[model samples]
Structure formats: C-alpha cells, structure tokens
Target chain A: MENGYKLSYLDNLESESIHVMREVFAEFEKPVLLYSIGKDSSVLLRLAQKAFYPGKIPFPLMHIDTSYKFVEMIDFRDKIPAKENVNLIVHKNDKYIKKRMHPSKFGMDKCCKFLKTKSLLDGLSSGGFDAALGGARREEERSRAKERIFSFRDQFGAWDPKNQRPELWSIYNARINPNESVRIFPLSNWTELDIWHYIKKENIEIVPLYFAKKRKIIRRDGLILLADQFNSPKEGEEVEEAMVRFRTLGCSPCSGAVESEADTLDKIIEEVMIAMNSERENRAIDYETDGSMEEKKKQGYF
Target chain B: MHKEKDLLRLVTAGSIDDGKSTLIGRLLYESKGIYKDQLTSIEDIAKKKGEKEIDLSLLVDGLKSEREQGITIDVAYRYFSTQKRKFIIADSPGHVQYTRNMVTAASTADLAVIIIDARKGVLEQTKRHSFIATLLDIPHILVLVNKMDLVGYSEDVYEKIKEDYLQFASRLPTHDIQIKPISALRGDMVVKKGNNMNWYDGRTFLHYLESVNIVSDRNLIDFRFPVQTVIRPNLDFRGYAGRIESGVIKVGDDIAVLPSGKKSRIKSIETYDRKLDKAFTPQSVVLTLENHIDISRGDMLIRQRNVPEIRDELEAEVCWMAEEPMEEGGEYLIKHTTNTVPVILKELRYKIDINTLHREEKKELGLNDIGRVIIKAQKPIFFDPYVRNHKTGSFIIIDELTNATVGAGIIWYPSATLPETENSQ
Candidate 1:
C-alpha cells in the first residue's frame, strides 16, 4: 500500500480508535486506562500516545495486579509508564491477599472477581473515575462480542446485556450516574492480524513469554501448563521440558502455554495464521468451566 | 494520488457455520496479513478439533461460546489494505438473534459483502442482510455465492442464484449492486480471479473493492465541521478542535461558527507538531481562528455559503437496536456530533419492511426494526442530509435511565410545524 495516500488497514483502524479515545477524554469527567501488560493493552497504550501527540496522554494508567503475574511483565509495566511520563497507579488485591485467599477455594472465576474486579472497583471508587478505558476486544470471547464500545455499567457495577446502550456512528454518550462507570474499548474493532500488523509496524515491545522458549511444563487438564513455583504440581503430575509460549497473559494458575517452536515474531504470526482453534483453547481454567468469562465480566473484570 | 483520498468501509454478514469466518481468514491469509505463530496456533487447533484441512474459521471465530458451539455471535472486525485503497471490514454474525450487531456494522459501511450458501440460494437471512444494507443507504453491495465447488463449479447454479438475488433486490434502495460466484473455501473469486468463471468478465472480489470509484460519494461542497473542543496552549494562540465533517477549509479562508453565527478566518491548522496549510473532510486538527470567538465544544464551524439546517424538530430514519421499542412521547438523550440534548419521540411515522421495501404504518417498532420517527428536541441541532454529510446527519438515542444506546437515527427533515423562513435570502 502507498503509505501516504492509501492507509493500511491498521492505519485506518488506528485513526478511528484514536478519534474515539479523544472523545473519551473530551466527554468524561475523569477517565483512566486499565493497562494490563499484554498485546492488546500495549496497542491501546500506543494508540493513546498517538491520540494526544505533543501532549501526554490526558488520563492516568491503572493496573489491577493479582500479584501472580510474570515478574517481567510488571517490570516492563513500571518502566514504560516512566518512559512515557504517563500517570501510573499500581493497584493490588491487598486485603484479599492479606487474608491468604487461594484460587482453589473459590475457583478461578471467583478468584478473578475478588482479586481483579474488586481491586479495580476500589481504585475507581477512590479516584472518583466515572469512566475507564479498557483494551478488551470482541474477538476475545462470546460475551465480549456483545460488548459496546462505550458499555454502560449500573450503580452496582453489573452489565445487563439485554439493557446495553445502542452505540451508533461515532457519537458516544459518556454519561453515568453516581457509583456507575463506563468501560470504553478503543480497540473493539481491531483483529488479531491488525494487532500483529500494528506490532510489526510500530515495533511495540511485548513480554518475552509470547515468543517460544524452552520452559518447564506440566500436563494438567489435557493441556501443557507452564510450571510456576507458586502453583506446585499435585502428586503424580509429571513435569517435563517443552517449548511453549503464551497467547494471553494473566494469573499463573489459570493461563496455560502451548508447546511451539515458533520463537520469532514472523514464526509466531505464521503459527497464528494457520491455527484453527480459539486462542483460549489451551487455557486450563477455561476447559474446566463454562461461562467463566461471563461471570467474571459481570463482576467487573476489565 | 487523486484516488487515494477516497476509501471504502465494508462489512461481511454470515455465521461460523456458513464459512464466513473462513472467508475472512482466507482473505487476510492470501493478502499476506497473517503472522507465522498465529498460523501455527491455527494449525494446532485444526489438529485438536480433528479437522481434515486447517479450519480457517477458527482464526476469526474468537468468541468462547461461538467456538464451543461452532457459531459466530457478534460483529468481529478484520482489517486489510491493498495498494489502491484501505479497508475496515466488519464481519458480522448471520443469526437472526444478533441482528443488532449487524445493524451496528452496517451503519457506517460504504459497501456490504452479503455471503450466501450456494446450496441455499437467497435464504431468509439473505433477504434480512440485504434489507439492512439498503436501509443504511450503503452505496454499493456485492453478493458472494460461496461454496460453489460443492456444486461442481456449475455455471448454471451460479446464474440461477444471481438471477434470484437480482429479482429480489429490485426493490432495495441500494444504488450499485454486483454479484460474484465465489467459493471462499476454494479461493475462487476472492483474492485471485477464478479461472472457472470465464463467462464472468467482472473483476475478482479484491480487485473490484480496490478499484471502485468512491471519490464522488462524499458531498464536498457542503462545509460542516462540528467543533469537538477548544485548544488553547499559549497566551497568543487560540484554536478550535474538530475533524472536518464535509468540504474543506484552508488557511486565511473565512468561516462561520454555527448557532452563534460568529464569523472568523482560519489562521492555521495544527495537527500535533505540523502546521497544515489546508485541511479537508475527516482530518482532525486544531484550527487557529483569526480572532478569539465564543466557540466551545459542540459548536460547529461551517462555510457561510453552505449553511446546514438548524431546527428543534427532526424527522429521521432510525434503526431500533434495543429490545425495548421506542415509545411515542418517550424522552431520551441524543448525542449528535459533539452535542448532547434531550429528545422526545413525537410520532412513529412508519416501520420499514426490510425484505420487501414496504412501509408498515405501526405505532410501535421492536428490536432490530427500522422505522421513521418525528422527534422534538429540547434544543435545536444543526445539520445536513445524511447524503450530504454522514457525520453531521447521524446520531444515537441514549436511554436517560440506563445510558444505553437504544436507537441509531439519521435525520430526514426538521419538522412540518416549524415555519420555513427563507434564510438563504
């Protein structure tokens, strides 16, 4: 494509999204971006940078950390915010963690509710934020497919799919009553290819685990799981060496890696192109339950 | 260089079962848009799912339930660009239940690619898709009769289906509609021109999409720029922020800010670091007015020669997206451009029969229904016809109670009650 005249598909999508993000800044009283150290979030961050060029991102960046993420992700998170000079607020489930709550007790979905959603809500409440920008895409899940670009949340932080606001044109109503907030998804229109193309075009840095690496793995729930020290294997569960990489990143307990030899960006993208299954197919937690994502989203997981 | 200024946005309508996902997957794949690892993961899934060939559908069927149930539930957007033009493609689900998603995708599209099962020529859902595309006023439409290889590359079959579609689409409001015999599964008439269809002289799907003349689609003479926000960085500089809704504005040209009717000259347009000598339709910039005016967010900057209609009452074509039908005399918040005002539905003119292009005079319209309504706003909105400028003509109805968007509307006329005083004189 002629770079100047004809916009690459990624370029046009980026233009529209940047327009939406600027609208978010113009309409909302207080808006913050929920920054998870992942590909989608990285793209969102870059879009924000482009949106307000010459001016720093008008909003702050918040991360609802479960404290079980890869250490490298957190390090990158901290360093980028400083490098960009974006306001950073690191939030964790301090109270729940202090109580020594385990994922085994309440299950993966509920654990996400307590440690992720609750912490995010807490941050919103204290900061008096009326709207928060998220990096979630409809292609991520079924329930998410029904999500709006400017999704409304009730006073109790519940998403009534049946009661979703109609989003038409580019005109977004960012109005919310007390205790209620909105989740603005600028990347709602971007696809996996768009994301990868954008990453390649912009040379956006992502965590190393996304690239294939030889790591200790365990066979659990018929999937190869990344062997984390925190989640020790139960009796008779054998651990072995496997070349694995993660499609998505989250708490170590639920997120699983697929065995692959594709280490470079080109190789990983080629792998994605030929793959015929959903990205979440390999995640152990998803296979064990149904509507797990919907339940978590209802509780306000970003 | 002249053609590059114009671009087309398209949406594809179908379900996972109909191979809509595979069609898009293959389109991206053949265009060299897919990455290596993504392809690797797709291969692994194909093996796990026990498919004979790599299931390209899995690449776009990203929803959890959709994947498990083998269906597509929502609008999944996919983007790919060619040398001649860029495209923002929205792949919407085919099910009747997710019709709202279809409406959302169709609202902004300049063209629609309606995919059909070759075995089931012109089904009920096919009509529904075409109907919505017409209602949205999409300038161009393409019917892809997919899975043709299943029918042994039968030219007779393709012709029968195309004729059936043309007969049905005769009543549609669309201007330019084309039909192509394609097998999204076998790569026929998609990225590469099909060799089997020697009788068909038209360009392949990708070629037609890239070459279609879109420069004349937009109304460039009517100037409309709805100011989003005011940007004042230093003591000496004062700027009005917005994307050009229609027409163009150049430095030193005189312009009028709407509602206020304050006139000012454009000093310069600044986009981040660069100072632009000229700005046109769709370019977002901060315009430095020659003099400090009373313009703020929601104010419009337009050429005095082509002023838009300013009125309190609006007659519009609305696509009802909510399960709750719009009630007569019901009030809601309407956000058009940067302006948000409370609006009441004065009357339900008539509901549209999407399939037949018939008008159903009804008191109520339900979910995924299209209707024309007369509305009275608490405040007047300035605008042009949707054909003149989509940016200023389009709006959304937000539920005052829930803040959910219940309807999407494009203005038709101001109202009958409002006295037509000639402002042009």
Candidate 2:
C-alpha cells in the first residue's frame, strides 16, 4: 500500500481526531479529557492513547460524577485510570449531593444544572484547564451540528453560538483569555455508526451496560429506564426484569434503555445499522424542549 | 459494513430558497441515512407549519433561529454513507455577507456543489460561491442547475445557464467542473434520476458524489511532516510525532529537519498498534531517527532535496473573518502548519470584489472582505505556494488582543522574489 495507498473513511476519521488531540497537547498549557464512561468516551480514550503512544498521555482525565450514574459505569471508571496509567479527577457537586438533588424532585433541568453542567464548569475552573476535550458529535443532535471543532467559551462558561469564531481548515485557533476556555471536540466528525465501527476495528473496551442483558427496568413516560438502587419504581410503577441495554450513558434517571439482545460488538453494530430513531432519542435531557440542547450548550453544558 | 470505503468532503453554499438544503436532504433521505425518528420529527414540524408536503429543507436547517428566519447562518455538517464511499457535507449559508462562512466550509472541501436556480440564471451569488470554490483550491466543482421543473425542463435554458457559468468560470482558475439540471424539490436527477429529464445523460448527483475521483487530489510528491510534539517515554526511547501532511516516508529514507536544516535517516516508523514500514499522507505516526536530533514541535520534516521556501516575508490572499477591520502594519499571531509566531500585516495590496472578480484599492479589509496582503513574520516559516500544496501553504492570523482567529490566508509568493512596488515601505 505504498504508491496506491488509500485511507478508508475510518482511517481518515481516526487520523483527523489524533491530529486534533496532538494539537491540543501542543497548544494548551493545561488540557483535560472529559470522560463520561460511555461508548463515545471509551472510543475517545482509545484515540487519546493512540495519539500519545510511546509516551503516557500528556493530560489527566476528568469525570463529573452525577452520583446517579449506573453502577457498572462507576465500576468501570474505578479501574480504567490506574490500568491506563493516567491521572483521574472525579468531581461532584458535594453541596447539591448532600441536599439530595434528584431529577424527579427538582425537575430534569435543575438537576442537570447542579449535577452535570455546574459540576463540569467547576471542574474546569478548579483545574485551571485551558482546553477541555469532549466526545460530542455533530450528528448526535440538531444544535450540535453547528458547533466548531474547537468551541470557545466565555469567562462565565457560557457559549455564544451566534458569535463563534470561524474555524478554517484544520488550523484550530486555541487562544483564549486567562479565565476563558475552549471545548475541543476531536470526535466532532464521527457519526454514531462510525464510533461503533471504530470500536469494532480497534477492539476497544466499553462499559458492559451497552450490551443487552437481563436487568431490572421500569417504564416511565414512554421511556424504558434502568431500575437500579439510585432509581426505583414509584408507588404505581412496576419494576420487572427484561433484556434491555442503554443507548447513551448519563445520570441513571435521565439515561433511557432499549430492549435488545445484542450482547457482542458485531451484534451491536448490526442493531445500530437497522435501528430507527437516533442514539440521542433515549437521552431525556434533550427532549425538555425544542431547542433544549442549544440552550443547555449556551449555559456551558457538555 | 466491513468494506473499506474512502471519505469524501463536499460543501454546498446556498440559502433555503436556492434548494441547497433540499438537495442535501434528498441525498440523505434516499440513501437511507435519515433515521425514522429524524424523519418523523421533521414531518411533525412541517405539519405544524400547515404545509401540504413535507419540507425537506427543515431536515438540514438545524438551528431554531435558522428555522424561524428561513436562512442558514452558520455551517452545519451532515454525514451519509453509500456502498462506495462515506460523505461529509459542509452546508453553509449563501448570502453575500456570509462569504467568510463559505470560505470556512470550502477550506477543507474536496468538491463544491454550486446550486443555481435555473430560472434565475447565474446570479452574482452563484459566481461568488464558485469563485471561492476555486480560490480555496477545491479540486472538483459540480454545478447543479436546480429548479428545472420551474423552468419547464427546457434544454435551451439549461444550456444558456451552463454557458454563462462556464464563461464566468473561464476567467478564474481551471477546475474539473460538471453541469447537470435537476429540480431538488421534485427530486429530478438528484438520487433516483426521475423521469422528468430523459434527455440528460449525466450521472445523478448522488452517483457523481460517490464516484468522484478524490484519491489523486492529495499531493503525494512532496514529503512534508510538521512535527507536532516529541515523544520520550524513557531514557531508552525518543520519537518525533506528527501526521504526514503529504507524500510518504519509509524507514531508512533520508529526511531533513526544517528551520534548523539538520539531516537524519528514518530509523523506525512506530504506531500504537505495531511498527510500520512506511506511512503516507494524513496518517498520524511516530518516527524515530537513526541519529539523535534536536527537533521539537513546529519543526517540519521533508525530503532533503525537495525543500520548501524558508522566508520571513510573504504575500498572501487573505479572507478577513472578524468583525473588526484588519489594520495595516498591525502585529498579530500567524499559525502555519505546527508553527505559531508573531506577524505584522506589512501592506494591504488590494481587496477583490467578490461579485466581479476585480481588484480594488483598499486601505484595510473589513469583515467578510477578501484581500491580498504582505506579511512579515518574526521568524522564517517553511512554506509552499497554495496552488501546489494546501497543507504547507495556508496560515491563519490571530488577533493579539482578543486572541480570535481574524483572518485565513493562502500564500502566493515569497516577498524576496516579488518585484518591488513603489508603495512598498
């Protein structure tokens, strides 16, 4: 494959993401990877390793534990950092946690604010990170399609979508003021299918919750939710065991599940190829309103 | 799903009225890229607006303000895959004031799909978009003479529009331009090759996108790798890490480090998976040299004999992207390849009129303005003519105060070889 070498689309996407990661490493003084312990985050972790192989990752990994995360996700997160030999910072809004902020109690909007959005901003500020890389993709949501690969945030951690800087070519402008920061999305171009394809190709390890298995679940507002310790059935709601799997990972209450029998990577890929709707359809936070994602992004939600 | 398919990046610049979004929406719909839920959401939106037929443009217009204003403001990327290739569409706004957005979309595009309303003929916006496509060095251009059903599918009308566009494009740089007539609203010659135009023999739009020859578009002759960072795990290992901007490098090949002009031999090509014998364009890999060299980020590696120009002063065509005007002789940061250095806008040569392709005398460039400017860098930069290799020849200017990327530039000539002008200071 010397003279007539042609890079497949997966290869192209991988190389592009690796290039972006390296640029962030070279440009920013303090950078951190936002790990969510989901499939996208798992793929991002592998890419980061590939990007800085022969040397350890130049930066640490940060996770905003919402306290409502799946048990398996927390279990997987506990062992990854030491195994990969990278620093891990898990930040949670202790004040809100002590107050017992739940989606059902304070509404999904306020719960997400204190748990995920506020926690993320606090984590970035405390670490004094100039750049924070996330696993957001353009195809995931409508509003996300317009985001730049290197998205800028103001001192208040607010996104000015209308006044975004123009990103030309692969030359990302990472310059920011002392308090300002840029959200780098190396996986901006990767579609959901592409992520699965890469995971299959690279044999990347992912959370076991993704594969369909026997689990306790409850039906709420037309969504199948995991029935776990953090999330329990209400007075009238019934908790039953079913073969279900999660499409996305978020707070246990906000993340939805789907009934399936795909327990392997190849089976998951087949399910995704023919699956209707979208990966984000199961995300409860996105369905708050028509432009909820846009509003959340403007408020500095990842 | 396991088949090896390449990626193609294409850009389409037009407002909703021009049927640009419809064309893209049709491509995604017919190719099975649109999921059922996405279709249902758009269908529900169309019904709420009291429309009889489903509005395809609603599928591409993702933002709320764009949907309310009926115009695209920023660039939105959409992805789709067929049997042959996977495509990334950079859909940008087409209004005159959004020239900067168009340029941003075209910078990394391999093909530009220019949608011209058949009845409107070749408008100034059409010419402007096409001119930008060529200026950004896109290898291919597909001219979709849209709204053919509105124009009665007349061959004469199609011929006249094609001729007018060809005449206007002849004055600009040459590119592989293809012309086709279709009604994006009626789905003619877009995906299904509808029976509305039996006289046309060209391939459908989707077919053209899938079959376009983009592999040869990459510059494979010049080996240039700008080191992003140096990897040193321990005392026993040291490697130079970078993505091959162009060409190929194999182990045991002679390589030269730029800026310092140091020479070394390729000792081993390393990757995360395994050791590689060689690497080609766009592959991110680590290379260890046979001899230790004092190399770091911002230094480029190239073939010894095939060297790029090392110059501190250069002339470039720039597109001002910021709201503030570009001041002549003002200092800013210029980032090229992996190097970032302070630069001064030495002179404002002339701004090009986007509509007529004519140069005008201008003291400074305002937002969305395109102009030629001479820049003087604090340190010499390795470069090539933008027409030769895009990776090595392009740069971006950052505002010193705001730290915003204010302008994107393409190198034209090194100032040392440029003829002296009377206005030169």
Q: Going through the candidates in order, what is the number of backbone clashes in each?
A: 36, 0
Residue-wise C-alpha lDDT for candidate 1, range B1-425, written one tens digit per residue = 31233457898886336667777888777765454445665577678879878877666665556667776656666655555665667778787455677878887788889988888888878888888786666778888888988988788999999999998887665468899888888888888876877777778888888877665565566778887766654567677767776777789998988899988888988765368787666666678888888888888988877788898888998888777888889998888999999999889999987766679989997887888999899988997766557788889888889666788888775655344542211
Per-residue accuracy of model 2 over A1-302 as CA lDDT, tens digit each:
34367888999999999999999999999999999999999999999999999899889999999899989999999999788888999999999999999999999999999898999999999999989999999999888999999999998788887888889889988888899999999999999889999988888888999999999999999889988897789889999999998878888888889999999988998898788878978888887877788888889998
Candidate 1 lDDT, A48-77, residue by residue in tens: 876775456878998888888877687788
Per-model TM-score on C-alpha atoms? 0.82, 0.97
Q: Candidate 1's error at B15, in angstroms?
A: 9.4
* Best-fitting candidate, scored by DockQ: 2
Alpha-carbon runs more than 4 Å astray in model 2: A1-3, B1-3, B415-425
Docking quality tier of candidate 1? incorrect
lDDT of 2: 0.89
Q: How far is candidate 2 from the true structure (C-alpha RMSD, Å)?
A: 3.0
